[model samples]
Target: MQWLFGSDEDILKLVGRRGSFLSRIGVAVGIKDSDFPVFRELYYEFMEQFKSRYSVYTPRRVFASVDVRGILIDGSELKEYMLFLRDFVNDVVNTSGLYVNFVFASFGTSRISLPGKAKPVSVKTFIESTLKSYFAYIPVWTVIHRTGIKRARVYVDSFSTSPETPAWNELCNNNEVYVVSNGDKVNLLISAADLLLGYIGTIIKLRNKKPDISELKSYLKPFGFNDDRFRIYHVGNRDLGHIIYKDPTVKINPLLYRPFPIVYLIPELSPAGLLAGKDERKLIESSHVYEYILRYVEEQEGSLKIISFTEDFKHLSAGGVVVSLGEHSRRIAEYLRLLGFPLEHLNARELIHLYGGDPRL
Candidate 1:
């Protein structure tokens, strides 16, 4: 296997997602539950040490380091490398600190049911058994400690497939505080504006420390800003989106921009996102419009490669190359013997181990 980038182990470790970003910061700064005052002291000390170094970011390279620890220099491979770092840091936080709890529910057998016949059983038997199991158990303290969110209270509701989410309607009708059902599921209505405001407040809190400007700059470059580009561009949807910017001194222009057609690595699309949101892969796999898009991209002259980035321990049982994009089309020709996709193989076995899977592989 010709290593695609630098050290395979390093790349794999870089992408392993388990921890939380806050825990990573705590570890880096050598702080513990000695509490907020202790954390602030350690944070300042870490900032002072970090400021002693020089950092730089441009289109081709990023350099940042901590004394007596290690240095990272990602050149041209900025996007992938940063992604690895972000995931690693978050995984640390998630494991060492705490993460919000989420529960998934599936409605009963029939998609369409006649009125009154619905028994309204528990979505999962546990919903009737435990308070912790029914609703999303987001720890308010963890959010405050890590993300600096200070939500006063939270309300949860279940939703069904119907217009008013039959579950929510029952709760409202009965005027019940914690009404729940396996049948009628209502939606939990989170206050988006409030969440966004709290998030911004947290960012402001972190920025107030006057962090090493160079370190911040290098950390941000991969999402498309370089020293030469002075302008920024926003594309894609509101929540899951990408941003691009350039510094004027580097002579980079925002106008001459093109988004690379990177392959999406996922186990499967969530049914909720598929039914409520627009997933490109699901749309292409299931619709006639996808055929048109595939034919158009394939007919183009440029060559492309379809890379299968996955884990050896996992498999998408509904195996098929669900989507195709761009001129060069290749598939993991060996992947269960699929064809006509621009294909490259990422060692899924290696990835699984890097993610702390069993040694047997």
Candidate 2:
């Protein structure tokens, strides 16, 4: 059903393109632009032609990190990935006949506990700071290193963080970077960024267990992109030592990062149960201590109903009702969050305390 990728899972999948007709259209849509209809028709023809040429960069397998409490863009492994990603962008720019005028990116969600705070700060705020610091190394650094300047339009996908935040303002003031925080996935190219990010995230979760994570043929079929779309470099134990994309001339300097213990939230898994790793399993298990995770994976064989603690969290074990969760219990919270459910991350005791008592009690 035309799945779009703009979730916490797609944190690293920030899509950006510059010097294209699409970018031009995106930036210049006046309130009384009568040429929109003609432009829209041309855009439709462009999408059809794009699909026919197989020009979309869909990967058979996705690659992502294990979500550890360290730098978001630290270490060589991630560096290798980003450099390769930059190459991929270059490829797209060349193939699509688009100039690299600006790069579009939207920040995804993340959860991290702030010092002296009872809970984590806003997911988007923490991610914004993390990403701003991250770009100082790669893509942004690489662009300046290769092109000799840092002047580009950065269309930010709006999240909780406002464009007026100090970091964002500083970036604009220093770099003349035109900041558009309300970019949407209305165009084909931008949507590819979402797919690309989701693909990396999926692979990161699956790469640890399987030799090649592209085994998700059926899972990816619904999205109209399959394994054959792009090449996957399958190397065991992904580290900086392995030249994944392998560009000998691309020398990488040590990246600077601020260390913070970050807790990654998760979405429901693939149809074949192939998208989670040991770290994710641990995250699911640890939530047991907090009580968001009620039953273990084993306990949820064939239950019905997915829950968001907001509306569906009514305690029910009697009175003609039984509160039960589906097999994707770990993902229920995340799914609810995506659907715009405001769920305060709470432990079982905290929930009981908030609600006075578990109604099932």
Candidate 3:
């Protein structure tokens, strides 16, 4: 119910003060921190609360390009999310500046071209193909320029490429100004989603605090953050469950939502869905995807489960499956194979992409 703003100073002051109140309230809820119970509790409480008070944005900004080395038989599955990986490099370089860091790794699943033999591909192949694919997306480079990203570096598998490959030389040429390989230790390792989420939430609250303020909000404009539908808020202690127990619309469907009984899965959604957006509420709903997503969560007893988003699966049917995906959903499909899930264990999305037709157009 508090007014949200987009100023850093104003937002920081507000969050800095409200931090304690949130800590006490969060414990009352069910949030527990592994290391610093008090600190983690408070930090989450603050983020959720701040999100409630303001808008949060999660941009898939920083990324490593991945290349698929082998052949593919399932055109649909091979190309499903693969388009994003293919164009990702050009997208970053066009949008970012000369000094940004982006790594390229061997990516994609082995099942796209195998006889039930899902081998773990090398990181080198992913990086190589990703850069090679970057060439196809150059026409849209100007559009990215208008969108305000300013830097990019392609990470490569030094062992995978030929001496004469353009990607190798391009990477080598830019080592001083435009690139960083995978092994290099750099200052930024944060998820693009997390950074945008926190940044947007804080900025929105800041704007609300000083309705007349100018400056910080301007930075958001270039990032395309000023749009009206992107509503955010700092989570009030009582509202934390909105993420765990209810949908983004605040609707509850026990059978289809979280905290509901699901076999072999734990539920987690990208925090981006928690913010205001059109129809994004579906991400939090208890559907087949939620079923598998939950099972995956339950499987991760102590490790972190990453939630990645892509339009790759958008072309699929049933909106996709319920299953455990690794850091990348594509990898999850492959990892499941290694874990002994049947080849039929394709995610709902994979099934759709493989056998289902496009419902959007």
Candidate 4:
């Protein structure tokens, strides 16, 4: 049968859960750690060489290396042939270099969940566990199905695993199977994974296809990916209640202009800006509204999913109320304002009552 299904000989793949983009999880096939160092050097070398010949950093020049955001040329036929891979990865896998087969998969937030959880997991735990479950099962899948491969090595792109993973435990029992993490490096394979995932994630972002997986299949065609190996693994979460960005690997580039929201203190709602000596007990008693707003910010703090140029014109209103918890409020607001966010301060009572409810400030 085709490698698409199962293979007869032992096969190995180095893989990583590429990035936790705000919307999806990008998965990449792997390269052996033993050969990664050499591969990484050549990869960067080729990028520099290409940069000298054709600049990729600037889009102002002819051909621009890009038209709008997408590349103007495929460059797939070039002798180097790897320039098609950019954004998330920069390394090259050339003729002399070990060319690790690149396969990719993406699971959107509204689709996949932590194996057992009912809700989409919190960002931190989501990052750690998702890949382990997927990476661990592939070899077992091939073996159980009688794919000819008798042995396999699955290298993962992770730094630590506290409790032993179920797949790791399974591999220990079988001499023919194994799994390992690379301690989270920017080595060749992970870099490539980054590129591949970033490409798909960008597509989802551009299309604004939140909660829809129908168009995802068409994206695989350009990559020549038709095999089950490139499983979309599309699951569904209809009311996913405010998905915070999961994978940090592929996220908004800070250099780009994006709205930076900051939590702020309410003046009229607060009713305390003029108080000289604040009573600690009364302060606590009066600040429950602040407590609620602060709680909301904590959960959604790191999730700046980013807006494209097309969205740049939209008004980004950031003058939401955050309680002045101490000396920190003014400082944080000043810093965010310097970064170009449109922010405003309000009294907790004003903000609360504006929403047609008594803040009880």
| TM-score of each candidate structure, all chains considered together | 0.17, 0.26, 0.19, 0.33
lDDT of 3 by residue, 253-329 (tens): 11121111112221233332434432333543324343333223223211111223342232222222334322344
Model 4, CA-based lDDT = 0.35
Tens-digit lDDT string for candidate 4 (1-361): 1111111111112233553333224443434446556654665565455556655442111111122134334443332333355421333433223322322222334434533456756543443444433332332332322323323343333322233343334433442332212111112333344444445454454444432344566653454443433444432242122222233343322212211243333222233445433344356434445334433333332112112224332333443333334444455545545767665544445544644446565
What's the residue-level lDDT of 343 in candidate 3?
A: 31
Write one digit per residue (lDDT tens) for candidate 2, span 26-71: 1111111243344334434543443344443221111122211022
Instruction: Please provide, for model 1 over 6-60, each residue's C-alpha lDDT reduced to its tens digit, 9 standing for 90 to 100.
Output: 0000000011244311100100011123232432343234333333543411111
TM-score for candidate 1: 0.17
Scored by Cα lDDT, where does model 2 land? 0.29
- For model 2, give the RMSD to the true fold: 19.7
Clashes of each: 36, 9, 48, 20
Where does candidate 4 have its weakest 10-residue lDDT segment? Answer: 1-10
C-alpha lDDT score of every prediction, in listed order: 0.24, 0.29, 0.25, 0.35
Model 2 stretches with alpha carbons more than 4 Å out: 1-9, 12-46, 50-94, 97-148, 162-167, 176-182, 187-192, 209-361
In candidate 3, how many Å is residue 30 off? 32
Find the candidate with the highest TM-score and give its number.
Answer: 4
Ranking by lDDT: 4, 2, 3, 1
Better of 1 and 4 by TM-score: 4
